[model samples]
Target: MDQMFQIGDSILTVSLPVELDHPNSQAISQQIDEILQEQYIRGIVFDFGNTTFMDSSGIGMIMGRYKALGMRQDSIRAIRVNRRIYKILNLSGIYKVMKICRQVEE
Candidate 1:
């Protein structure tokens, strides 16, 4: 899985691969953690334009990040989600904590 992080003044944007399943969840989590530690991140924006699959591990990863940022009064957001993934996010209750945006697919 490939991941990229964009450091911003207030928000750290994370772009993850299309398949965020068990195989790469750990790596993704580690990457995110490292970025959070290395930067003064106030919020996270997850770009889901490329993500196509996710599992329980992905949910755990998101939840863990949420907790990590919660301590700092930060927030998380998601963009460019497809229909299938949107349903997963809804069922996982991520919508309660993160803002959802309909971005133009790249």
Candidate 2:
């Protein structure tokens, strides 16, 4: 499946695609920007259950949202991240800015 976005309780949950490369990352970033402009989002949750590959563009996209959200603590989250993606997130220093979870939080 492609990327999907869901919003609830002021949080935006982004269900990422299997491959988060330059092409899709740019599109996803634009879509998320539109959503941000239209809604009163308090946080963002990136769901990586179906994602297996991610490039630097993906990391940049997430960071863009972090900045868009005013860099609030716990305002960004990564859930269902696999080992490979976890390593990427960790090495990209995303762990320092966002919450990384093995499972979705309620």
Candidate 3:
């Protein structure tokens, strides 16, 4: 569970873990929800560079944050999504809600 947050401007860039499954997914959602509450976050950028696998819980987590952010629809994004995970997001219609970038963070 390697996660790090890089705050940029009003974007809360989050580096996700390799396996974003249950338990941790719920924890991550809770943590992000907490931040959105006490802070003035305007957007979120999820970095999926290291993520290899994920379950439906990942989508739930993202959706939870999107709703919690008051539907700041255009501010949510996902970065460095590999083919496998990209398929997951694509099939889940996540791209319609957030931007997908193949660029990895160096």
Candidate 4:
């Protein structure tokens, strides 16, 4: 997984890997947590541009982040989601927790 976190303005952008499974998801989850603790994040954008596969662990990762940010009322958005992954996210009911953006703000 490409593990890169980009921050601009009030948003933090995280580009996920092509396959968001257990190992990578764990790393990502930890990284995101570290970033949240270190930065003043107003919003989070999870970019699934290169992601082609995701599993239950990925769902857990997303949900965990969503709930953590929710406590602070920090907004979260999913971006660049293709149809297949979008279906997974939809089935997991993540849209109810976070906004799904058509285009992510830079």
**Order of quality (lDDT):** 2, 3, 4, 1
Question: CA lDDT, every prediction?
Answer: 0.80, 0.93, 0.85, 0.84
Residue range 1-106, candidate 2, lDDT tens digits: 1339998899899999999999989999999999999989999999999999999999999999999999999999999999999999999998999999988763
In angstroms, the error of model 2 at 33 is 0.5
TM-score of 4: 0.87
Residue by residue across 4-72, what tens digits does model 4's lDDT show? 799889688999999999999999999988888988877888999899999999999988887777644
> Where does model 4 exceed 4 Å of error?
1-3, 71-74, 102-106
Better of 2 and 4 by TM-score: 2
Write one digit per residue (lDDT tens) for candidate 3, span 3-61: 47766687798889989999879988878877777778899999898999999999989
Candidate 1 per-residue C-alpha lDDT over 18-96 given as tens digits, one digit per residue, 9 for 90 to 100: 8999877788789889877887778888888899998889878888898988744438888898888888999999778
User: Which prediction has more favorable TM-score, 1 or 4?
Assistant: 4
Ranking by TM-score: 2, 3, 4, 1
Predicted model with the maximum lDDT = 2
Top candidate by TM-score: 2
Model 1 residue 78 distance off true place after TM-score fit, in angstroms? 0.5
By how many angstroms RMSD does model 3 differ from the true structure?
2.5
Candidate 2: where is the Cα deviation over 4 Å? 1-3
